[model samples]
Target: MEYNPQSKQEPLDTESEDRFASEQPSEFQQPYQYQEMKQDFKHSGPGIASFVISMVTVLGYVIAFVVVGAMATSVFDQSGNLLASASEVIITIGISVLILSALNVIGVVVGIVGLALRNRRKVFGIIGTIINGVIVLLFMMLISTVFVNAGGL
Candidate 1:
């Protein structure tokens, strides 16, 4: 292709683009539909739901961590023998883990549904499913360790 000197060219607005992001929040800013990356596609609702549920599971995990931290000193005596309060830790961990696992299961189910949706973006669904699956696997490993320690190997 030959460059035609006579053809008119649109000037690039380099100054506007070079401005810092914080200095560019104006009502005149282009809406999403007008942006170059905007597409004729919608994100799946189920995918969003799954992602949200995955985030919620993190809260339960945090609670479990807090319980473990608060009770760490009592879980075992200085002699390394399991103490009476160890049972409390086990029960709390067990109950919280089960609840979190249930949430992960729900997230996975919703993510699957999102992936099956027509003409919808699958990024969130894939991400949520992978995160939830990994968490479930980690929980399984923890439970297996408990069994092993109990002489169930």
Candidate 2:
């Protein structure tokens, strides 16, 4: 028997040639594609520096809270009434620190998401950085207010 390659007609109503060409996997689909890693297209967005600064600002507030609490506790322990009555200052600082930490955590979460989804929208990373700055400023104001009030100014 003789081989007949063109004896059968291809399915109609479509571009079978294009479909067949596309269906065939090329060199790009090889397993080695995984080994050939590629970096993100946008590398200059809000990066490690912004992340570090944001974290440091958040941590500064937390450290301030601890330090202020320690000082207030020691004063109360040593003094009979005058220093102990200054508890309001410490309480305000602690609450402010807690609020700032929560906001910074939110900023970090947003930054991570922005970094992950940068392919979809490039501005998200910048937005995350802005959010972090806002968090830092809010905390700064709170701490400054405590200082002013405590100093009787």
Candidate 3:
């Protein structure tokens, strides 16, 4: 019902020093099993490689698109007529797509390898796999579209 400063006395042994007296040691040392477990878990190297590859592929796509967009403007005359040299833009796009496609393929392969590592952490592996797989699928679709259009199908 009311606050009392000296209501009850705390145990003298629990006054910080005596409380930790038995718990304290001459030096800090971890348990053997704990130390072993601490060193057991690590990030998979291939997983990191896969993630980096995917990130680079994404950046490459962005840069390629931006560059192509900039150059494409020059391919169109102000009167909406296509220039005779528009083939260069096509060639640039083809090369960019091929390179990005290859990068995604590598990322997917590396991510799969990472996932196969028995003791390593799998978060990056799974994420990289998914990202790379999606990009590869998109590239496949793009290639298919090109083939279809070229064939007049």
Candidate 4:
């Protein structure tokens, strides 16, 4: 087409403008979709905290068990006599177990609260609750065994 310096460029035809506008997405639609996705992925802080606490408590329990087993093995001599420091080690392990058990209980409570909040992290809360329940059961079993072995049962 020849250039016409005297004439202003004509605006797009209405039909072409409408076609272009229709091809491109609406600004409002994009933000609504983005917001919906953000809401879907929203996290529950308490649920996450409960999960983390439960995991830590379970790990501590395992480490405590291993340490206690090692101490029990090492503290006895060939004559089967307990060493002077063996009781202290046992007492320390017992105290740690008690503390971890308490933490597990707290995790369970937090998980329940998280679930009750009906947040997006409910799965984590449920998992945390289940883990804490198992840990509590294990703790009770260990305590009962200790008592039975000590002739307190």
lDDT leader: 3
Per residue, candidate 2 scores C-alpha lDDT tens digits across 31-130 of 3345432353554344444465566666877687777776666555443664745767667776766766665766666566666654444454565577
Assess every candidate by TM-score: 0.64, 0.38, 0.71, 0.66
Clash list (residue pairs), candidate 1? none
Tens-place lDDT digits, model 4, residues 32-90: 34334435865677788889999898789789888888878878889999998899788
**What C-alpha lDDT values do all the predictions have?**
0.82, 0.62, 0.86, 0.82
Report the CA-based lDDT of candidate 3 relative to the real structure. 0.86
Q: Which of candidates 1 and 2 reaches a greater lDDT? A: 1
Q: lDDT tens digits, residues 22-79, model 1?
A: 4656777854565434256688999989888888898779978897888877778788
Clashing pairs in 2: none
Q: Which should have the higher lDDT, number 2 or number 4?
A: 4
Better of 2 and 4 by TM-score: 4
Instruction: List the candidate 4 regions with Cα displacement exceeding 4 Å.
Output: 1-41, 144-153
Best by TM-score: 3
Candidate 3 clash figure, as a count: 0
Q: Which candidate do you rate higher for TM-score, 1 or 2? A: 1
Give the Cα error of residue 71 in candidate 2, in Å: 3.0
Estimate candidate 2's alpha-carbon lDDT, on a 0 to 1 scale.
0.62
